[model samples]
Target: MNNETTNSFIVQIEQKQLLLTALWPMRFEQVQQCKSWFAQSAVKAGTLAYGADRVELGLSFANESFTFCYEDYSESFWVTADSAGGAMLLSELAKEFSSLEIR
Candidate 1:
């Protein structure tokens, strides 16, 4: 995990007082790809929140929020959210990339 990028994302979430309700582990490349898909798919449904580094990305949909960050110990990226809808949307997006393991 890149401390600078991770901390930036954490600060944003804290400032928003968002609750993390779900987390999905994925590779760095996978996370990037997911970010692109999200930016395209949610363009009509929500707003995109992109940080300085490509790894720090998020989406706001309705009342839910989805964020991409790194899991330090796992040395991998994770997609976190504040609601089940976020998880559902991620699942739907992952369907387009069979290699992505949502669990």
Candidate 2:
């Protein structure tokens, strides 16, 4: 396998952190596809937590040109990224992806 480090994006909603890192076979078009997938996905509330009022939410974004994943939650259903700390982390990764040259 290639040892090169591919670019990846991370998501954090509240205290939960989700990572989305790019994989091998770098290609600008492929990266763009991933970016588009992220934009198209709808962030829905996850499941109920143990003893909190917070609701977990699922973040579905592109892992590659043809892959995706549904993040897990511990104690919530819906997460707010507009005014959450994790938004910044996600933004940073997006910015990094934007700067990267696909291949």
Candidate 3:
């Protein structure tokens, strides 16, 4: 990506504090899959919300907004903003969940 696009994307990302391609929610059932994936890592996820039919994952990592959160109520996975170094960390995490099905 060019500097302009990258900078612009970064601006947009900061504005929203997330990296959502299209704002579509995931299926609630995917929580099971997400749980399994998260379990493999030692990182602890913060609970944003939860109920009989809803749950939300929120966590701040390394004193940054770098988090991989999923909301059962909204059924959406939200990627928090990350620095260049954080991106590298996320890249490694990505290798484990290679088959992320976005809905």
Top-TM-score structure, candidate number: 3
Q: Candidate 3 on 3-89: residue-level lDDT in tens?
A: 111211221233324433323444666554444444444444555445566555654444544555555555444455456655545
User: How do the residues 1-103 of candidate 2 rate in per-residue lDDT, one tens digit apiece?
Assistant: 1122334332232333333344443343232233343442232223222222222223332221111232222221122333244444443434433344433
lDDT of 1 by residue, 1-103 (tens): 1111221122112322332222344455554444444433432223334333445555565456766554434444445655766655544333322332232
Residue 64, model 1: lDDT of 62
Candidate 1, clashing residue pairs?
none
TM-score of each: 0.34, 0.22, 0.38
Q: How many clashing residue pairs are found in candidate 3?
A: 2
Instruction: Compute the lDDT of residue 59 as modeled in candidate 1.
Output: 51
Residue-level error in angstroms, candidate 3, position 71: 6.3
lDDT score, residue 1, model 2? 15
lDDT of 3: 0.43
